[model samples]
Target: MKPNIYVVPRWSGTIHSDWYDWLAEQVEARWQVPLRRLEMPHWQTPRVEEALAFLSEQVPGLDEGTFFIGHSVGCQSILRFLHQKLTPESTSPNVGGLLFVAGWLEVDEPWDTVEPWLDRGTLDLRSVRERVLHKRVLISDNDPFTSDFARNKYLWETRLGADVTLYSGQRHFNQKTAPEVLSALREMVEPAN
Candidate 1:
């Protein structure tokens, strides 16, 4: 079977730029895989559960060993959602590897991103790390909200046992600047060991 990769962008991003249809239209010509995206708008609602629910619906349809590309706040939501689903008894057959782009492992209350994260409470962080053994945290070396990139990387690596990558001169890893994110997602779609 061909690969099925899900591109989950943050609350602030959109389908056109981050997961541009043009790229999909182009890449599909060669890969023949279904490269698609789902919108997670709970950040505007300021509720993490709503976004998690949206993601949960898709989890069932995804094939085993599916690739999940989560960006910014979507990364946090996916982790929390995964932890909720895969406790001890419950298991999702779809999950394979997690590729978190510009992932926000640390909970911050930025004026825009604060209220929604606060709604989920601090406890969710522990839940996510406890379950998300396979995770990658991509940090921007010059993120505006973060004071120190190394500090954030350390926080995620220590808390979630995440493999952190700090990309220089990038801010938030948004579509405007991070055009290479498409290639990054493609790489993660490789069969996981």
Candidate 2:
């Protein structure tokens, strides 16, 4: 069976799945893999625990064919979900891959709304790395959220074993069309060389 692509959006993200319509359509038209964009509850003031629970409920089970793509805080929530929630067990299935865009481990700029999710003590990158088969992290050079690109790159690549891709001016990537992202998703869903 073709892998299912699950897109988790940024914090305070809307329920409107149209944001990912372009990428979703491209992937579906080419590979026939369906895309399901999850709407985070209480998007105005998001709580990591709540988002995690919601995602857990939405995706009851994951397999080797389940692929995840998360942006910004959505990336943080997804990583935590995989590490803290989906513990290694005989019954739990391994995930195919994970794609994180503008994902950050620590917040340089303090914001009260996002403080709960910034507690890195609660996240276990090692466990997350173990649960997934392949991983990719994307960051832009001028991304406001991630001021220190080197640190972000080192964290995901050196520590978590993800293939990191850097872009020049793609700030936050909140647009409907991202060719690089679309291409990456296409390659990931396709059979490996």
Candidate 3:
């Protein structure tokens, strides 16, 4: 069976914004995979618990046939959801993969709104790393909001065991189309030997 693909959008982002729609189109057209573009609750002012709850309600199942592509804060939601849901006694199979675009461990500005997310203490990635079969992170060198590229890259690599890729001038990856993201998703779905 073709793996189910879920696209989680950025904070303050909609299903139609940026590359979400384009990626969904490409995934359905090329691979014929069932793709879901999640419309997060309170996207403009997202709270971690609410986001996770929304995911729990929206995602029916997770297993080896499940894949996720998350952008910005949506990345945090995905990781947190996995960390919360996947326990030692969990019976579900390992997830297929994850592709995080413009993901961040730290942010640059708008401290007030993001403070809650950042202050939630260290995210335990051990469960997530163990449960996920493959993990990849894509970030921009010049991302305005998530500018600490080196630190973010280090954390994603060391904590989540993700293959980190740095792009030039991608600026939080809010463009209309992201070939890099599409390419990475394809690789995760059909990895080359």
What lDDT is obtained when candidate 3 is compared to the true structure?
A: 0.87
Position 103, candidate 3: lDDT: 91
lDDT of 1 by residue, 1-193 (tens): 5666677777666656554465566458757876667766644544676778888787665334566677776676766777677656555454555777777644444675465553333544554455433566677877776657887888777766777777887777665445466555555555356
> Candidate 1 or 2, higher lDDT?
2
lDDT per model vs. reference: 0.63, 0.79, 0.87
Error of 2 at 110 (Å): 2.0
Q: Which model, 1 or 2, shows the larger TM-score?
A: 2
Q: Which candidate is the best by TM-score?
A: 3
List residue ranges in candidate 3 displaced over 4 A. 119-121
Q: Give the distance in Å from residue 113's predicted Cα in candidate 2 to where it truly belongs.
A: 1.6
Give candidate 2 misplaced runs (Cα > 4 Å).
Answer: 15-19, 119-121
A best-first ranking of the candidates according to their TM-score comes to 3, 2, 1
Candidate 1 ranges beyond 4 A from true positions: 19-30, 61-64, 107-109, 118-134, 176-180, 191-193
- Tell me the TM-score of each prediction against the true structure: 0.77, 0.91, 0.95
Which candidate gets the maximum lDDT versus the true structure? 3
Clashes of each: 0, 0, 0
What would the TM-score be for candidate 1 when compared with the true structure?
A: 0.77
- Candidate 2 lDDT (Cα, whole model)? 0.79
Candidate 3 structure quality by residue, lDDT tens digits, 29-103:
988875799999999999988999999999889988789999988888898889877877788779999999999
In candidate 1, position 111 carries an lDDT of 70
